[model samples]
Target: MTISCPTCKKPSAPRAENKAFPFCSERCRLIDLGDWLSESYRVPVGPDATERDGVSEDEAAGRVRTPDDLPN
Candidate 1:
């Protein structure tokens, strides 16, 4: 099967010896890696504003109000 490189748009032959399977060459592979490291690619967390550790914004906001809320 023949595959085209996403970066260079070059046609590449499919073979077990091809280290850069999808990419045509090492340069294209490295470019893709650089994009990942530079934050060009983003994986969405979610719509909620809460922290990943389960700390909600409202809970954090409530911690600072009123002397009665403080522990002895």
Candidate 2:
């Protein structure tokens, strides 16, 4: 069977021996990795999807105001 590299879309035969299965080569694999690390690629988050560990964005940013921390 034939498959295409997810990064460069190059068609090639897939084999278990291929180190970069979905990708054509190590270069293509690295490119795909760079995209993920750089936030160029993102998994879809639904409205119902919650943050991991239940930490809201405000809490994560330390924006939750406390009485003692309130402005005078």
Candidate 3:
């Protein structure tokens, strides 16, 4: 049987013993994983939506300004 790597699209021999199935090598698998971990691939989200910790978007956007806002 034959299998092609999903990343490089290289032809690889299908081996039941091989741990890296669907990928030809560890490098290709790691590269694919790095793309995900480093956000080279992204899931689309709607605009005007942001992640906030407890604070409403308006409140977060309109935070108080003070002289302390300036770095010493």
Q: List the residue pairs that clash in candidate 2.
A: none
For candidate 1, the C-alpha RMSD (Å) to the true structure equals 10.1
Ranking by TM-score: 2, 1, 3
* Better model by TM-score: candidate 1 vs candidate 2: 2
Residue 52 of candidate 3: its Cα lDDT?
A: 46
RMSD of each: 10.1, 9.4, 10.7
TM-score of 1: 0.46
Q: Of the candidates numbered 1 and 2, which has the greater lDDT value?
A: 2
Residue 3 lDDT (model 2): 94
Error of 2 at 30 (Å): 0.5
Cα displacement (angstroms), candidate 1, residue 57, comes to 43
Model 1: residues >4 Å from true position, as ranges?
A: 39-72
Candidate 2 local distance difference test against the native:
0.72
Q: What would the per-residue lDDT of candidate 2 be over residues 1-72, giving only the tens digit for each residue?
A: 789999878884476868887888887787778778887543334565455545766566786566898677
**In terms of TM-score, which candidate is strongest?**
2
Estimate, for each residue in 1-72, the C-alpha lDDT of model 3 and write its tens digit. Answer: 678987789975466755777788777777677677876553324563345433576786788687888988
Ranking by lDDT: 2, 1, 3
Q: In model 1, what is the error at residue 62, expressed in angstroms?
A: 48
Name the lDDT value of residue 37 in candidate 2: 88
